[model samples]
Target: MTVLILGGTSEAVALDQLLADQAPEIRAVVSLAGHTSDPKPLNLPVRVGGFGGIEGLRHYLIENRVVAVVDATHPFAAIMPFHAEAACKAENVPLIAIRRESWKPRPGDRWRSVPDISAAVETLGKPPRRVFLTVGRLELPAFADAPQHHYLVRVIEPIGDRLPLNGVKVIQQRGPFEADEEEDLMRREGIEILVSKNSGGPATVGKLTAARRLGLPVIMVERPPKPDVATVDHIDQVLPWLVAQGIFVTERGV
Candidate 1:
């Protein structure tokens, strides 16, 4: 039986690893949106790029005879979750999402939450301040309007000429960064504010911690609403769900 995973996150990698080790009989494919130029290798077969839309995805599901789908896209992914929900329902396939929780402000966090990236730009106002941007390369264009501020952009992939800012420096790096390192970067760069999406994961939470230590104001872009579907926060729960669907075989006979 075939399973399709809408993947791009660390959680997706973990779930794929679990399936590879524990359920060898279940054939799984990991689908990426092709954002990262050099994504790390995975155990399962990986398909990069889009599935067109709902109609295209629906066709792929029917053609592949996929028994299930796991939506493990990024938290800020605004379209794919809805498309997956619609396509899976049409194909009569069991679908589940690994919806990671949003980060909440702690006692020392000086956060200013905004609905979206545009709002975050507006919050920066007319005054020029050194800003550290961790909201990915795709969202960088919106900051062009606020060109007065110096921006330190950290992305996994090269930004090229996407962000047309007057004073901006791009650092291509992937992370599970430490808080002390993050603090040092902020201090050295003279970052006055931080602009980040509420992409809740342990891999990149150090920036928030460092911001708290430095008492830097952060412009937190809240997550967009995800499609209402069967969801779990942890990757551990996925195998049991797959077993219950009768797609995963277990030696313990779960």
Candidate 2:
């Protein structure tokens, strides 16, 4: 009689709050990947770290009696959604993914879309450029191959000895940054090129807007393939879907 929420995004937090306020009888648990050391606290029951793999996840759904699962992880996440789909199927539990829409280029956006991170490095070319890197801490090492470019890396977690390049500057901060501030940073750093993942959320999208205003070329890394499952873009839609699934039954008569 529990709903397992695979959480890491802002959408997950909103959904958790919504359920807590509206569906008081339902037992909802938020599971985090533990990417950030000090993740924002949520009111619902929270579980941290991975469930090993697919077999481990399958065991969790069975043991916890998880009737449904919501995949609200980050778009850049490549593996977890597939694993959730498989595990939920194995357990005969319903699964839904909150697939945020990818950002489309506007009139002034100078974008070069590539399939993955490696291709992005290849796109950077041999000549050194002042690169604004926002693809997160996990994939920072990939830039090691293209060490000639100076990288301005911003991450939520401290990137200690992760990228051993000579001209790399690390800034640890959380986002939903203003476009004016983003523009100022880019101009001050003399950024020639911007490298970012098409993560498709407002929290970090100010970089793209700033880039567009400053007329900087962006090497956008596209999201990896995720398993096709029941999907929606917003958090508000989740509770209705759960109710429709009969996971949260309503009592009749007065």
Candidate 3:
């Protein structure tokens, strides 16, 4: 049974690496959304971009003979898994989600939870404060209502257009950033408030830690609800499932 991995997160990459090394005989392909300007290389053969929609995905699955699916998209990705679930159900193929757990507020963290990006902006209030905007480029526009605040946006690439905030500085960096680095950035930029989506993972939690140390209040956007489906938090758990499908043969080499 060929496995299709809906990839774009670290968990997806881990699963791909495991499959490449342990289940080489299993024909597996990773699918990337290609939203990032530059994404890291993965071990498995990857197909980039969307599959048109539910029908397009159904057609691709039927055409490629995909027997099973593993959905390991970013936590904030609310649409792709929905499409995967619909397509897999229609095709009668088993599907499982591999989601990384989100971050919980620690003892020192001063977190104010918001339902969405717009709510987070509202929580920031009328005062013009220097903000560390860690929610990503797509969510940046939500701050248009509060443009008086200075923003230090950390992104994989520049927005390449007019920013919603009048006072802004963009930092181009990739994870995993260290705690010391995060502290330095906050201090250098004189950030007073931290805004972030609780994208649960180790690769990008340094800002939260730094905020805690500096006693800065964080506007944490809660993660959206995920679709109901079989899910796993670890990579190795999928091996048994693959074996159950009679697909994890011991063929060597990638």
Best by TM-score: 1
**C-alpha lDDT score of every prediction, in listed order:** 0.93, 0.92, 0.87
User: Which ranges in model 1 have alpha carbons more than 4 Å from their true place?
Assistant: none
The model with the greater TM-score, 1 or 2, is 1
lDDT of 3: 0.87
- Per-residue lDDT over 56-166 for candidate 1, one digit per residue giving the tens place of the 0 to 100 score: 999999888899999999999999999999999988899999999889999999999999999999999999999999999999899998889999999999898889767
Per-residue accuracy of model 3 over 38-106 as CA lDDT, tens digit each: 778888888999999999999989999999999989999989989999999999988999888889999
In terms of lDDT, the poorest run of 10 residues in model 2 is 245-254
What's the TM-score of every candidate structure? 0.98, 0.97, 0.95
Query: Model 2: per-residue lDDT, tens digit, 1-254?
Result: 88999999999988988888888789999999998898888979999999989999999999999999999999988889999999999889999999899999999999999999999999999999999999899999899999899999999999988899899998889988989999999999999999999999788889999999999999999989999899999987887798789887556411
Which prediction has the highest lDDT against the true structure? 1
- Displacement of the residue 173 alpha carbon in candidate 1, Å: 0.7
